[model samples]
Target chain A: MTELALAIENLSFAYGAKKALDDVSFDVRPGECTILLGPNGAGKSTLFSLITHLYDSRQGRIALCGFDIKKQSLKALARLGVVFQQTTLDPDLSVTQNLRYHAALHGIGRKAADNRIQEELERLNMFERRGEKVRQLNGGHRRRVEIARALLHRPSLLLLDEPTVGLDVPSRQAIVEHVHALVKEQNLAVLWATHLIDEIAADDSLVVLHRGQIKAKGKLDYVLQTTGANDAGEVFNKLTEGHKG
Target chain B: MRLLHYWRAMMGIVGRELLRFLHQRERFISALVRPLVWLFVFAAGFRAALGVAISPPYETYILYEVYITPGLIGMILLFNGMQSSLSMVYDREMGSMRMLMVCPLPRWFLLGSKLIAGTAVGVLQSYAFLGIAWAYDIQAPLMGYVWILPALVLVGMMLGALGLLLSSLIRQLENFAGVMNFVIFPLFFMSTALYPLWKIKESSEILHTLAHYNPFSQAVELIRFALYEQFNLDALIFTALSFFVFMSAAIFGYNPSKGMMVRKGGGAP
Candidate 1:
């Protein structure tokens, strides 16, 4: 219970002359949703890449469930479940096949994999659609299948990168609610990246990322109080308005 | 216990390739049609122009189809390799590749598994082409069929690794078509795939030297020997070396430390 699901320290990444992330540090503990709020080009994707070891961090370190990403990448990655901003499902494959394939990748046995797949699909309320191809599903339902796939491995940390990007308003609200429910139900740590102010609840942990730096980080109320703002919308404006010029 | 996971991962990759192959029916048709066209149309046209002498692997004068069958097999593998690489580029852009890399396997193992999967498809395409050729009464020794399996696999790995290396270097799908022309034509025409090195030597010394050194020629010769149940140690060694070198280059090009040099897509995982 004392262990953080994810920990990053002084992580930085550069692409040629451009610095994408600089000295960014944070921790995501179990059973909480940490909303990483940032606008476009604010390095949210870059940070996720580094965290997932898409690109190696030259100047800092990252650990997942106490496993170092650079030195112990397999162990670190084993504890992580990720859904990219873009839909990663195979359009020709049925939902159960996709989930089973993911479970195989995680080294889960056939019997255990099938059990977990059934459990996850039922939890996500998509068990009836398990036999349908991914192409047959709507965007919102597809996202739900991806969520079910991510949970098949029982990962401690679940990372969602702008998951609700192209979904409708109701779909977006429902996904946020579903993920919130997951945190309470499974004790999973989630770092959900989004620019939508409405997604950040007053009690949620919040981190405002601007210009590749963490401008503010704390509980929503604490961040609002520290910035002398009335709400998250105002606080975001106050923290990022200076960089627009 | 860990071995079970590796086996599952390998099967998963191979199963996915087969599934994709089935979905894209055009790919399978085109893969077979290209080699069959060469065997029927191109070989018939060249039969009158090119003369065959009794080579070591050949006991009697053979028809043009018999002479170039191994070369056509190599062509199928070459195209399949590039096609697999094209899909890799597409997958990288579409984000499924990131999902693959995030699995708790070593990066080399992941890449190797992908190469093996692609090679399996290439080998299958070659056998299909062989089966079609059999319908025309062109048959190898029955024992040669079994012996040719390993040679086809080796050639497949060599060509597929070459494709993987190219995919790592070439980022954009729009730019890949041009690369196919540069790579496939030069490899096919300059090698012993179309004409023997001896014939090229008779035409031009420079072309002869190039064909002598071409790894594709070595691969074609390897298959040609295996078709007759003969062994060529030199061809085997050269192909094994090419596989190692090309696979190493691919692994390096996809390395995370050298991010900017490869994978132009942003924020890849």
Candidate 2:
């Protein structure tokens, strides 16, 4: 009965003669964490680009919180937050400064932005380091600041594109746990793209994308049952058979 | 409320540029140094070789440094424009530009804000160069300093918009060096920035025509006239038209559906 946080229908994209994404369709609901599982070069980033409106495709329709991305981009984008695979934070800026910039981009006032920055940083156990430049922080702390920036506006949906790729295990684990907690506590919708199976919680949703197509999608157990696989890794391997990287 | 959002976003972008400019002392120094070198060394050497007839911007016979001061100001705007473009390319490669592009505002507004921000920096550098020129005894009319501000903003936006257009066309950071050599040098050398259009005509009519039509020439003329509290209708129209053209092209080039974004698969190659 609740509105979907994100919806993509019949999405297709191509780079000249090569197809990047083909007829991909999926949905993410509030209070859910949807893990997009794919190997390298499996069109995961392409999908993120489309949903974020970084790339446009004529053959598809994408909606964020009931607003079409093409027709109402401002409203649609206002409901979305993203942390790209590469670090988008200004390295020379302090953590708070970076967050304030993002908050300003979203039209948050200074006072409200400060409060939100503190709340997000404190939640991530990064409040004590807000004054440090992002360049001075280790990889883990930088990612935490990025996460805080992404949540500064408190969007209805969050899209993270391989956010944990270069991070160590503990940092990776901390982000995974924090995002899961956010979903549960705030009823936020999250579509996180990553190849790491260990990041998938038992009750989370799964969408296995392979070679630009959605191979299997649903609850974790549903995907396992449909693919006849024993676990998340098995499901991924089965769905993307012969294309393993 | 909506207007407030747009105002805040512009302030944020401009403030960030100012902060970045402040932090990069080398960039500031180099921006000033480039023009200062041309004024102190290059102009001094050419003073004997070049004599100025009474031009509209020059009421009486002038020293070469005084004549070339406006051109040097143009040089500052031109180089700052290219430098801003280079940074845009770098930001694209480093992924910071994507953050700006994804903001919940119209694409034209965002690009325009960037153009405005770059122009602000360019204008700052222009004023700094003018200050140094003043101390060096090459002074303009007192009110000329104030009049030149609007002219500098217009020309800076025109040059900065051109830079934005180039950034969209350039696919990689490595390719930008070619732009500097091929684009920047030709624009600087062929324009009246260094030589008067009449002097250029004495040598080659073709080169004179090219220099006459160069937007950079119009920009320099605009600044020169403004510094003397004079108005140049021709330069005003040409520079404004050029700004519109370059800015529109840049906005189109950054469009997600049809621009370089589609060709590059949404980000730097």
Could you say which candidate leads in DockQ?
Answer: 2
Q: Whose TM-score is greatest here?
A: 2
Estimate the lDDT of model 2. Answer: 0.91
Name the runs in model 2 displaced over 4 angstroms: B264-269
Query: What tens-digit string does per-residue lDDT give for candidate 2 at B1-269?
Result: 99999999988888888888998999999999998999999999989999888877788989989988999899999999999999999998888888898889988998888889989999999998999999999999999999999999999999999999999998789999988998888888999888889989999999999998999999999999999999999999999999999999998888888898687654632
What is candidate 1's lDDT per residue for B126-200, written digit by digit as tens? 999899999887899988888999999999999999998888887778889999999999999999988888889
DockQ of 2: 0.69
True contacts kept of 2: 0.67
TM-score of each model's B chain?
A: 0.96, 0.98
Q: Each prediction's TM-score against the native?
A: 0.97, 0.99
What tens digits encode model 1's per-residue C-alpha lDDT throughout A203-228?
Answer: 68998898889999988989988999
How does residue A217 of candidate 1 score in lDDT? Answer: 92
Q: What's the count of clashing pairs in each model shown?
A: 0, 0
